[model samples]
Target: MTYFPKLLTICILACILGATTFFYVKKSVYIFDTNYFKINSVSRAALKETGSKQCKNCSEGVPNLIIQYGVGRTATTLQFQILCLMMAFLHEDEINDVGCYYNRRNLVKKYNVIKCHDISWYLTVKWSKWVFMTSNHALLSRRLNYMRGKIKDKNTTIPFIADIDLVSRRGHYIVHEYQRFFGISDEKMQHIVEYLRYWDVLRVCCGMQMSADWRNHLAPKAKYKQHHSYHSPTYPACEMYNISQVEHLLVNTYVFKKLSHIGSLRDVIGKTSTVDGILNGSYCERCNTNISKMHLKFNQNCA
Candidate 1:
């Protein structure tokens, strides 16, 4: 009887240990489903026909296919809406806001937009250009760990990795700093000032009279909070950031160290210019200049 009881106790302990190990490993890795990419018909066909993971003969005019891989808690929805509006203004079509996949109608379609959140999907797929959106580590961790009630861990815990190194060197990628969205401007610094002015007016007008869903999904009441459960059209203003926390994340994390290898916008475009300047928008020459001039015009309907 004693032996049996001891054996039973051992078995229970083993099971408990196994379960703990499983949960720990699972939490450490990013969890996603097969449909995460939602690869559309056009991309599916392209992959099948080419038997390669690269878009051939891509140029700057209108990308054959553009993948916007916005990191979680990184103002993805905001960027998506902004890009969609810009596309509409430019008369472009076939933008899928959910996942990074699109079907082109014809040659005149110019380009298609697909928002991809899966880092795994981004690493495996092929596309003409990638618009990578992310924020500093401090802000990303805070939002990811946000809960209305009690906290789980005493110290900061990062369940997923959003390092810049995951970006593939085989293709073209543009790392757009999320912080810049707040004070977005060009070399001259006028578009975003005007854009923010319009954004403020829309926020007030819709904030007072909008439906519950509209208010929750479109505009966040708090500056630090995200616009929606999923994505936001704009990041909180620069004033909302915790400067001390931002500095802490920068100094403590190795992720930001990888960015040092990436050349700043002012630096001569060379092999090291693997990505557009990530740490600050002031260093991002292309984004500050081209993006302002070529794209990003205000649209009334988005409100």
Candidate 2:
């Protein structure tokens, strides 16, 4: 009997709470044939938080497994970037510990850290560390509505939601439990921030058609409307709710405030799909520079 069908059923239920945040343990594994996960006896690894300098050499034993799980619109992409940066500080061989290099789009590795929006996690007897990302319910709903272009006005709200209490508890966990878990030093943090800043800038450039090459490179198969970077101007225009509370809490916890410094609704509204369109935006040299740098970092030959 294949578990594929059952696994899909489990995925829908697990999507709500499992991916958002939770750790479970049980003595035995039994297919209850229900939504609940009957976690197996997997040894949860106790990792000692080490700074970037201390990670100069890889440990002798099996490298600790790190997994970051979250629902959509909870900054999963941003967290993925942060986790990748964290993975890079490890010894050269361990640097490829992540399952795949996003920039290179390669998967020749046994991933040390796994990021999943889907609650498809399974228990392995091997040691593992889990990081569950959560977001405020209001903020999450707003993001969802925006991404789907469902906004009508300030009163407009999305039916889907994030758990409020989980968001608060996770915020506290970030403060107390694993502040240095990623082992990012000050210098590394600065670089990560700069990288994030440039990343968003390039995103804005692509959205505004300031860099056609980047848009083509990033979303070759996607149409302008279907592009991952696509944003509806109505959502932003109608967004009167202040998600600043969540942003503030996240910034205090993870120092991820640079995200707000990126492009705005005007950029999205200004996008043009035509080659001959007289766009007000000009090509960004910095965007091209970062694109080349990224290509080089991923061992891709720059054009």
Candidate 3:
């Protein structure tokens, strides 16, 4: 049970939604079996009549948890970066001009079009905060020397960074490369990686899903695609069970709440995955009872 397939599921869903966007690509959105998701209340748009249609100052009046305070993500977070930035835009974070550190900063054209050209977010604490929160390496590298100075002067809190293992791992090579390329000191880099806080991608995915309920904004012209590896359990599971259509793309309130606390999608293999790719918990609350039912349904689908 690895996090690989769960991410694939998300990628698939993103491609499904991408089909409607301006940048379209040929792809299949594998709609998994949802006999387990016996959600009676149909998922509906849960938007608020908050003032201007735009988020003038994203951080200004956002209720707690409006934008997730993620921590300790690595280079393996490429796809999640797209989703995170997209989520941030929905929340009205001024990121159009903020070059995304996807493999390289300010590299992606879509995000480039999103920038506030000529304007720089480099001076703001929000920009620094987001870089640290989401572990945006590009901006962090450019600002690291200044950021360390800020911490010394008590100007800002320390941002999370990756450690030796997490950064150097196979899908995480970029962390090291970026750090070396930026000439970050061993001591500072070590501290960034060792700091406490583990915002798992699986958990982030679920959080993003919650954001999806209200923060449904998206790019109309960005091309989207799904990627899955040979080791992805979800691929095999899909092949075996073969769910043709997904009734509701949304996870209900109960499952949503349940996923918030105890999801281990990062650890779960892909086959017979949950809608949110949430891992089934050992303890069964009413919500988890539904998860149990979901597992049963998935097994039944395969049977």
Candidate 4:
């Protein structure tokens, strides 16, 4: 009887060890799934085809497709919340495909938005001195700029609903920062100024809320000028503009269509719609000039 009990104990221990090893190995490996890329989804394929055709007029490269899958009905909202959570925990790394996949699968449904906001707030309170320092700001800005360039080049736009959530989160961060510094006195006015400043920073770093007229006009002209009457748009240029327009349309379809959304707005305006144009030139003359001045002022302040 004693021998049987000892054998049972050994077997149980072996099983426990085996299970732990399996989990450790599983956690260590990063796997990419076709579902993550929406490879088998019709919606993803269609979006890719449309995006590729549209981006061909731009000078930069674009992703062949923009894919959206679901973690449930609330996937978009959950995804945004998860992004905020990961940014809080992971410290803004390169955001590789594998990292994105793992983070999405692991965290999306596990945390609610309110929970995420609390965790993020806790992190900011505990780590703000380390995280939100001026030196870190430059690093964060560069990382965001790099990500923006990658998205622009791939011609892949994030989903509009998700973008809205990101904008909202950014706005919240701005207000939070103001409250930390300014307190409750004049809170309302400070909130508005902070919101505008937040948006301005987003426009500069994230390429949010772009005008479609720039893509329609400037992209084609840049293509033509670069290729010297290449006559028809090339694949890359077509893909870039297509992605750009679709992204812009997703955010503002009616506004995009009303702005003479056509081929090559730049030729008419006498300019080029390179990545710089897409980033800085897509706005109307007034907004563009204002953004430029703000950029100058920002640089001066940084200096």
The number of the candidate with the highest lDDT is 2
**lDDT: which is higher, 1 or 2?**
2
Per-residue lDDT of model 3, residues 31-112, tens digit only: 2223223221111100111112322343343221111122323332432332232323333344332232222223332222
| lDDT over C-alpha atoms for residue 223 of model 1 | 47
TM-score of every prediction relative to native:
0.27, 0.34, 0.21, 0.21
lDDT of 2 by residue, 129-180 (tens): 4333434445433443243232222222121122334323342122222225
Error of model 1, residue 139, in angstroms: 7.4
Candidate 3 global Cα RMSD: 25.2
Deviation in Å, model 3, residue 295 alpha carbon: 21
- Where model 1 places Cα greater than 4 Å from the true spot, the runs are 1-59, 90-110, 139-303
TM-score of 3: 0.21
Candidate 3 Cα errors over 4 Å, as ranges: 1-136, 155-160, 163-223, 227-303
RMSD of 1: 18.8
Which candidate number would show the highest TM-score if scored against the true structure?
Answer: 2
Which regions of candidate 2 deviate over 4 angstroms?
1-63, 97-111, 138-179, 203-303
Superposed on all Cα atoms, the candidates' RMSDs to the truth, in angstroms, are: 18.8, 20.8, 25.2, 22.4
Worst 10 residues of 1 by lDDT: 265-274
In lDDT terms, how accurate is model 2?
0.35
Lowest lDDT sum, 10 consecutive residues, model 4, at 126-135
**Model 3 CA lDDT for position 62:** 28
